[model samples]
Structures are given as C-alpha cells and as structure tokens.
Target: MPVSTVSIPVGQWFTDDSGRWWFDSGSLALDFAYTGAIRVTVAPETLHAPDDLTGWMRERFPMPVGVARSRDLFDAVSLRDAIGRLALAAGRGEELRAADIDLVNLYAATPDIPPTLGGGSRQAGRSVQTVGQALSTIARDAVDCFGPANDGRVRICAGGCGIVYLDTSRAASRRWCSMQRCGNRAKVRAHRARKSGKVALTAA
Candidate 1:
C-alpha cells in the first residue's frame, strides 16, 4: 500500500523568508512546466546550481511577476527551491537569514501537484494536514540532515529570505506574508458568511 499522508492545515501556513514568502509566490501565464504530465525528480547537483536559483527567481519572482500572475508553475519552482535551500542550510547548519527562509516557505506554499513530489499544503493546513505535514516533513528532514542553526547565519546568509514570510518582531507571528490570496480569501468568506448568514463555511 502507499504511504499514509501527513496532515496539512490552512493556518499552518508558513513563510519562506519574509516579504517574498508573504506574497504567495507569484507565477507566469505560460506555466506548462508545472503540469503533472512533466516527469522530473529531485537531483542534488542540478538543484544546487546558481543557474537553477536564477532561473527560478526569474520564473516565479520575476521583475514582472506579481499577485495577478501568481499560478501553479510558480509553485513548482518556488516550492522546490524553498525545501531544497532549507534542507541544504539545515544540513550544514547554516544560519538561514530572511532570504533562506523565504525560499523554503515559497517552496512549501507552492506546487498543487500531480501527486508525487511535494507541492506543499493544498489545505493551507487542514485536509488531513497533507500540505502542512509535507512541509513539516521537509523542515524536520532538513534539520535531521542539516543540523541546528549555526552562528545565526540562518539570519544573515538566508537574510531577507528567512524573514520574507516571517515577522521581524519579537513575536514573529507572521505566516504567508500578505493578506492578498489566503487572507483575502478568508475575508471574502467571512464577509460572505455575514451577508448570507451561513452558520458554517466550507474550508478553503
């Protein structure tokens, strides 16, 4: 039988870095690359390439990319980048600054998926905890493979990436990075509920 799924919650939402992660990791119009039909697996060397990072940045967080453009393809690269970077940093015990964390959070939040590779939380952290659980697995695995934070480098090297989706304050109670997509969705739902007077709302 197949392996059991991990739990993913909606509010279990995570931030990769800070601002970057806050944005829901935007994508482009022509994201055929993200279709489940594509068959690719994780390769260590290719993923670690500076080229990969550059290409990914251009693809998902392109200068032209924005919330309107946010799509599944963006999730593919971003989700991969996030988990991979975190795994690397965690493995080496690198101090993941905002930059580093942003990458991973993006990774976790993207990838709606063909069902094989981790596309992160579809439930946003609710459906049996599938998506959130996958991210947790990635983080936990990263820590197991990488190690504890080293000399606060996770904050420097990772830099804005680490804090992009996270709050910079002592409370640090931020998750997605923006109130646009998920947050707005929640608001819309609440507003609709108030208007319709629905006692219960379906999960997003």
Candidate 2:
C-alpha cells in the first residue's frame, strides 16, 4: 500500500558537526525537522510543531514511517543532546570526554530493523528502523569530524545562530552558515553602525 502523503511543512536546516542535514534556527530551540522526524522534545514553547511526522520523514529520509512513538522520540532527543554537545566541543577545539563519546556510540550502535521484501510494489520495508538509521548516521559523521582528515573544516558560526558546519570553502575562511543568511545580516548591521557613527560625528 502506498503511504499517504501529508503536507510537510517548511523547516530551516543547518549543518552541524555531526551531519550535513541537521535542523537549526534562531527561532527554534531545536530543529523541527530533526525533532519531528526523530520525535525529539524541545522547549514546550518552541516553534516546532510535529503535526505531520509521516510527511516530515518522507521529505528527509526514504524510510517508511507513521507518527513516531513517544519512546522513540525520547531516545532521539537523548541522542541529539549528546550530538549537540560533541559538536559544540569540536567547534571550540576542546577535548571530548570518554563519557560523551560513549553516549554517542551507544546510540549509533542501535540495531537497525532488517529490511524485508514487501508484497507487490514495495521493494523493501524499513519497518521502524528509520530512527536507528538516523542515529547511526549521525554517530558515524561525528566520528569522521573528530578524525584528522575533517577536523580542520569544523567551525562554529560567529553569527550567534549556534550552528556548526564544515568549511568547504577554498580559502577555508567561511564563517557563518551562509553568506546570504547570517553573513549578510551581519554585514548590514555593520553598515548601519558606520552610518550611525558618521551621523553622530556630524551632530557633534
């Protein structure tokens, strides 16, 4: 049976140290894309509304799923918390304690539901292993980021968005998550400050 498509709402995504598709926003305490698909919890007042979890999962991963269960959601939140801390530590060039690594690895090693042949048009069914796959992928990426080959590319955005990304720029000088987003906003603010200074000088 074809899974019904729900109206997947638009969400803001930012790359974190753990993965390239991490959801992020200044408005959201945590990315709804991650929280909704993984069923994680954020502040109650956060703007992340996970009304259409099925559609949300489809938009990101190929795993078939209905609404996420509460237990899975809790687990996702826990794993995400560890990922956030590890990413932050990497961004700051700080050491990661063994406990932090262990937490991430524990989630990463979650056994995936074996894919089985589905009747008719369904090639293989994910059952409910989507969450496991997602968590493991995050763990693998985190491991890579800590490796020497990619560690130098890790950077925390200076724009205060609290986002982390691998700087793939040729100059390795990429700062904010995007030149059009946080970077441009910072430039505009600086310009306004210069203008304000000039006006004050004239008045003086």
Candidate 3:
C-alpha cells in the first residue's frame, strides 16, 4: 500500500530536555506539525491515511495504536483542527469562542485507548494506555498553552508555516517556530532577496 502522508524532520515532535517531559516549542508543539494538515497541505503531507495517523501517534507520543481504522483517523484529524484553532486564537490574543473550547474540553475528558505497562527488567514498569487517552492529553496540553502565563508568550510563526510556538526567549523576540527549520529558511530567503536587489542596482 502506498503511504499517504509523511512529516518533515520525521518524528521529532517531543523533545527530551534535561529529563523534562515537554515539547521543545512548549505545548504548542502538540498541534504544530500535526494540526496544520487540517487546513493546509504540506509537501510530504500530514495524516492522510489511517497508517499515517498511527505512525504519527507512535512516533510523536510513543504509543502503540496497533492498527488505526478510518474512525480513528477522523477523530485524530478533528482533534488536531480543534487544537489548531485554539492555538491561533491564543496567539492572536483573541478570546476563543465557547464552542471551540467545548470541543477540546470534551476530548480531554475521555481517552480512547488506555495505556499498558511493558518493558522488561527496568526496576519499574507501567501499562500501556489507550490511544484515546494519549490524544486527549495532547489536547489538554494545547489548552494549557492558552493559560495566562503562557498565552502572552505564544507567538504565531512569522515564517508563514502556519505553526504556533511559545516564545520563551529572554527578549521574547522569537519569530519562527524552529530556528533550525523555519528561521533558517526565512534568513536564506532574505539573503537571496538582498543579493538580487544589489544585482539590480548594479545593472541600473
């Protein structure tokens, strides 16, 4: 079967920094790469097939979804879009509609798949939970991003990649979601433009 969608930076969503469990871009990363596929199409695409959804969940959240079905795909897509809407609104400092918040709240209440503990001889173990719970937690994280303390720090990427991130920089002047990705691309484009302008001046 043909793969429906793939991700850039393949499966690099969750960042383990100094033994802390958090995304590098704050909670916004929960919806960053996955959510954009809801409205816009990426080059490799996001979640187009059930397998894609399963893989994304497995890689990003480190959960086993087994075989993802059509229904699971739909639910995943829906949740992603809801989170994205909230992130955008938060970044813009616009009050979110009651319905939007309700959507996320509903999913946050119940988990589709429960977790189970597995891993041999590690001194301790935990069971794997359902995928539904994993996804719900992701939504909850997105909601947390809208909290007062972090909301003001939220920023929509200026690179036009349709990603939102928490600007934790001391100066609070961060403009891109990832300096290695979006930031570098923006700089390269600007450099090229400046060079082009210089050439035009020489010609004139």
Cα-based TM-score, every candidate: 0.25, 0.59, 0.64
Off by over 4 Å in 1: 1-50, 53-164, 175-177, 198-204
Instruction: Write model 2 residue lDDT over 1-204, tens digit each, in one string.
Output: 101121122335544442344233311112332342222232122213333333444555555655555555565566556656665676778987678778767755665334355574755663554655544544554555455765566667788765665565677788885666678789999999999999999999
Clash totals, every prediction: 57, 1, 17
Candidates 1 and 3 compared by lDDT, better number: 3
The true-versus-predicted C-alpha distance at residue 59 of model 3, in Å, is 1.1
Ranking 2 against 3 by TM-score, winner: 3
Kindly indicate the candidate among 2 and 3 with the higher lDDT.
Answer: 3
Better of 1 and 2 by lDDT: 2
Q: Against the correct fold, how does model 1 do in TM-score?
A: 0.25
Mind giving the per-residue lDDT tens digits that candidate 3 earns over 1-204? 111111212223422221222225555334543434324333134678888877766665544445678987777777777766766777777887777678777776775343344565752224454556656666556556565656478777787866566676777788876776667788999999999999999999
What are the lDDT scores of the predictions, listed in order?
0.33, 0.52, 0.59
Candidate 2: residue 2 lDDT (0-100): 9
lDDT of 1 by residue, 80-199 (tens): 455445533442455556775654444434432122334565533223322323333333322322223222222211212222221233443334325554455567777987966654
